[model samples]
Target: MTLHRLILREIRHRKVNFALSVLGAAVAVAAVLSTVGALRAYDRETEAVIDEMEEATKAEMAKLEDEIRKSMKGLGFNLFIFPEGQDLSEVYAEGFASRTMPEEYVTKLAESGVVTVNHLLPSLTKKLEWPEQKRTVILIGVRGEVPIAHRSPKAPLIDPVEPGHLVMGYELHRSLGLKKGDTVTFMEREFTIDDTYEARGSKDDITLWMNLGECQEMLDMKGEINAIQALECNCATVDRLGEIRAELGEILPNTQIIETQSTALARAEARNQAAATSRAQIEAKEEQRARLRAEREKLAGWLLPVATLVSMIWIGLLAFINVRERLPEIGILRAIGVKGRTILGAFLGRAVLAGVVGGVIGVVVAKVVKLPSVDSGPIIESGEWIAAIVTAPLLAALAAWLPSLAAAQRDPAEVLRHD
Candidate 1:
C-alpha cells in the first residue's frame, strides 16, 4: 500500500489516539483565539470609555462656565482705573474719584488690544449739591460702552443712562418722594426719573445716574472722566493685576489701575476650580484604562504560552504511544523492503491529518463561544483565522517528528523479536 493509504489505515485502527491528538490541537487554537479576542475587546472598550469621558467633561465644563458667568455678573466690576495723581484713600473714603482723566483715555485702553480687562465703562463722578432738591448726592455720568476690536461684543454690565432721564438711588428717591417718570432738576438741567433702585446699603443709595455728555456739560468738565470701571479677565495666573497695570501703563501712562482684591480673587478661584475639576476627571479615566490594559496584557502574556506548551506535550506523548503500538506493523513493512522514509511519512501524515481536522473544530468553537470578559462578540480577524489553521498542522508535525524519526530508525529484526 502507498504511504497515504498506510496513514489512513493507521488512523482508522487507532481512533482513540487520533481523537486525543486532535483534541489537544483544538484546545491550543481555542486558547489563542480567546486571548486575542479578549485583548481586542479591551481596546474597543477603552476607546468607548474615553469618548464618553470627553463628552461628560465638556458638559461639566460648560455648566461650570455658566455658573461662573452668573457669579461674575453679581460681583460686578472689580478694577478701577483713575488718574495717576489721585489718592486711593480719599477715593475710598468719599466713594468717588476727585481727579479727572480725559474721556478718550478709556477709548484708547479699549482699542489697545489689551486682553486683561473687560467691560470698560467711562464715568464722570462727583459729590455735588442738588440745587433743586436742596440735598447733597453723588452724581455719576455714563454712556454706551466702547466696542473692543479684538473681542466679541457682550451685553453691557451696567446699562447706559439715556439723555434727559435719571436712575436715582433708593435713599435719594425715597427721601425726595420721587418715583419713575417724575421730573427732577439737577445742576440747572431738567431730567426725568426713569427708574429707582432698591436698597443696597451703600453710597449707591445716595447716587444719581445721568447721561455722560449731559453731566460733563453741567459740571464744565467736558471730555473728561474721573473713573473707568472694568471687570478683570479671569486668567490662569495670579498676577493678573500686575499684567493689566503693565498693559495700561504703556497705553495710558498718566492713569493708575486698582483691583478689588475680594472680587478678583473670587473670580479667579472659581475659574481655576472648574478647570482643575475637569482635568482631574479625564485623568482618572485615563489611569483606569491604562490599569485595565496592563492587567489584560499580563494575563494573556502567560496564558497563551502555557496553553500552547501543554498541547504540544500532549500531542508528542500520544505520538510516542502510537509508535509503540505500531512497532509490529513497522517491522513487517520494513522486512518487505519498505523504506524508512515511507514509514516516517506515514506517521507524520497521520499527525497532519489530525491537525487539519482539529484546526477546523477549533475555528468553529472560537466563533461560537462567548467569553465572559468581552462585552461585545468574539473579535476574530482574518490573520487570526489563518494563524489558527496554519499553526496547528505545523505544531502537530513538530510534535510527531522525534517519535516518527525513532520509529523509522528501529531495526526490523529487534521489532519482530519483541513482537
Candidate 2:
C-alpha cells in the first residue's frame, strides 16, 4: 500500500489521539484571537469619538462665522472695547455685564479730535432678576445712537422711551409672555412696555433696552459703562479702521481696541480647541491600545507558547506509544522490502493530518465563542487563521520526529523471532 493509504489507516485506528491533539491546538488559538479582537474594538470606538468632536466643532464655527459676517455688512468697521481679562467670544455672544470702563471714557472718546468717528454708543449691561422665570434677563443701556434697532428695517421701531417705559427685544417679550401696555417690576419700580424691537438672529433679540441714564439709575452704577461700540466713518476702509484702533490705543491705554477681525480670531480659537480635543482623544485611545498590546504580548509570549508546548508533549507521547503498539506491523513491512523513509513518511503524514484537523477546530472555536465582558465582539484575522493552519502541521511533524525515527530503525529480525 502507498504511504498515504498507510497514514489514513493509522489515523483511523488512533482516533482518540487525533482528537486530543486537535482540541489542544483549538484552545490555544481561541485565547490569542480573543485578545486581539478586544483591542481592535477599542480602536474603532476611539476613532468614532474623535470624528464626532471634529464634526461638532466645524458646525459651531461655521454658524458663528456666518452670523458675525452678516451682522458686519453696512454696519461699518465697528470697534468693541471690553475689559482686559474678559473673553471676547463670550462678550461678543452675550453682552458684558460687569462695568469695564467709566462713563467719563465715553465723553473722552467722543471729544477726542485725533480719532474722528461717526458715532459712539457707550453701553451698560446687567442681568436683572426675573422672579417669575426664576432666572435673569440681559438688560442693555445705550447712551448714544441705537444703531441695531434703527438699522433693522423689519423691526417694529419704537419712539424714544420716556423714562418709565421699556423697549424689549422680540425674543425677550415672547420668553417673558409680556405684551405692549404690560407692567413689569424692576429695581423695585414698575415700567410699562412701550414696544418690542427686532434684531434678526442676533443676541440683541434676547436683550432689554433702556436709556443709559435710566439704566444707570436702576443699577446704581451712576458713572460706569461696561462697553463702547463705535461705528466707523462712512468712507472708512480697513486701513482707516486700523488708524482708528491706534488712536483708541493712545487714548485708552488700558483698554483693548477690537475691530471686526474679532470674527477671524473667534474662528481661529474654535479651530484650535477642535484640534486639541482631537489630539486628546487620540492620546487617550493610544493609552488604551498600549495597555491592550501589553496584554496580548503576555499571551503570545507566555500563555500561547505554554499551551502549544503542552500539546507537543501530549502528541509526542501518543506517537511514541503508537510506535510501541505497532512494532510487529512495522517489522513485517520492513521484511516485505519497505524502505525506512517510507515508514517514516507514513507516521509523519498521520501527524500532519491530525495537526490540520486540530487547527481547523481551533479556528472555529475562536470565531464561535462569545465574550460577554467585552462589549465589542472578537475580531478574527485571516492572517491569524492562515498562520495557525500552516504552523500546526509543522509543530505536529516536529513532535512525532523521535517516534518516527525509532519506528524506522526497528530490527525486523528481532521482531520476527519474538513473534
Candidate 3:
C-alpha cells in the first residue's frame, strides 16, 4: 500500500487518538488568536479614547479661556504708563501726573506690535478748581482707545468723551445739582453734561472727564498727555511687570509702567488654576490607560505560553500511545520489506493532517467568537491568521518528532518475538 493509504488506515484504526490530537491543536490555535486579537482590540480602543480626550481637552481649554477673558474684562485696566521722571508718590497724592509727554507716544506704542499690553488710552489729567461750581475737582481728558496694527480691536473699557461735552462724576454732578444735558462752564469753556456716573468710592467720583484736545487747549499744554492707561495680558511668566517694562522701554524709552497688583494678580491666579486643572485631568487619563494596558500585557505574557506548552505535550503523549499500539503492525510491515523512512512518513503525515484541519477550524472559530474583555469585537490581522495557520503544522511536527523517530528505529525482530 502507498504511504498515503497507510497514514489514512492508521487514522481510521485509532480515531480516538487522532481526534484528541486534533482537539489539542485546535484549542492552542484558538487561544493564541484570541490573545492576539484582544491585544489589538485594546490598542485600537486606547487610540480612540486618546483622540476623544484630546478633543475634550481642547474644548475645556477654550471654555476656561473665555471665562478668564470675561473676568479680566471686569477687572478693567491694571497697568498705568506715565512719562519717566514723574513721581509715583506725587501721582498717588495729587491723583494726576505733574509731568507730561507727547500724545504721539501712545500711538507709537500701538504701532510697535507689542503683545503684552492692550487697550491703550492716552489721557491728560490735572487737579484744577472748577470755577462755575466753586468746587475743587480733578479734570481728566481722553480721546479714545488706540487700535493696535497687528491685533484685533477690542471694545474700550472707558468710553471716549465727545467734544464740547462732559462726563461728570457722582460727587461733581450730585453736589453741584447738575444732570444730563445741563451746561457747565470750566476754565471758561462751555461743556454740556453728556453723562453722569453713579457713586464710586474712589478718585473717579471727584473727577471730570472731557475731550483730550479741549482739555489740552484749556490747560494750555497742547499735544501732551500725562498718562497712558492699558490692560496687561496674563501670560505664563511670573515676571509680567518686568516683561512689560522691557517691552515698553524698547518702544517708549522715556515711559514708566506701574501695575495694579490686586487686579493683575487675581487674573493671573485664575488663569493658572485653569491651566493646572486641565493638566491634572489629562495626566489622570493617561495614567489610567497605562494601568489597563499593563494589566492586559501581564495576563497575555503567561497565558499564551502555557496553552502552547500544554497542547504540545498532549500531542506528544497521544503520538507515543499510537506508536505503542501499532508496534505489531509495524513489525509485520517491516517483515514485508517496508523501509523505516516509510513508517516515519506515515506517522508524521497523520500529525500534519491533524494540525492542518485543527488550524482551519480554530481560525474560523476565533473570527466568529467575541472575547469578553473586548467591547467592540474580535480583531485579527491577515498576518496573524497566516502565522497561526503556518505555525500549527510546525508545532505538531515538532511534538511528534521524538515518537516518530522511536517508531522508525524500532527492532522488528524483538517486537515480533514479544508479540
Query: Cα miss at 273, model 2 (Å)?
Result: 8.3
The segments of candidate 3 whose C-alpha lies over 4 angstroms from its true place after superposition are 8-19, 81-109, 119-146, 152-229, 238-240, 246-256, 262-273, 324-328, 377-382, 409-419
Model 3: per-residue Cα lDDT over 20-115, one tens digit each? 999988889988898888778878887787778777878887777677665564344567788999999998787678999999999899999998
Model 2 over residues 293-372: C-alpha lDDT tens digits? Answer: 67766655776678778888877887888788889999999999999988898788877877788788877776777665
Superposed Cα deviation of residue 160, candidate 3 (Å): 11
Q: How many steric overlaps are in each model, in order?
A: 0, 2, 0
lDDT at 142, model 1 = 91
Q: For every candidate structure, what is the RMSD over all alpha carbons to the true structure, in angstroms? A: 6.8, 11.4, 7.5
Against the true structure, what is each candidate's TM-score?
A: 0.66, 0.55, 0.65
CA lDDT of each prediction against the hidden true structure: 0.84, 0.70, 0.83
Model 1: lowest-lDDT 10 consecutive positions: 69-78
lDDT of 1 by residue, 1-419 (tens): 57787788878888999999999989988888977876787788778888887888788777776667555644545678889999999987886789999999988888889888777889999998888878889998999576667899986666789999999999999998999999987877788998998897878899999999989998999999999877667664557677877877788889887775557677667767877877787788779888877987898899889888898889989999999988998999899999999889888888888788888788778777778867875678988888899899889989999999999998999998977
Output the number of the TM-score-best candidate: 1
Candidate 3 residue 212 C-alpha distance from true site, Å = 13
Q: Which scores greater on TM-score, model 2 or model 3? A: 3
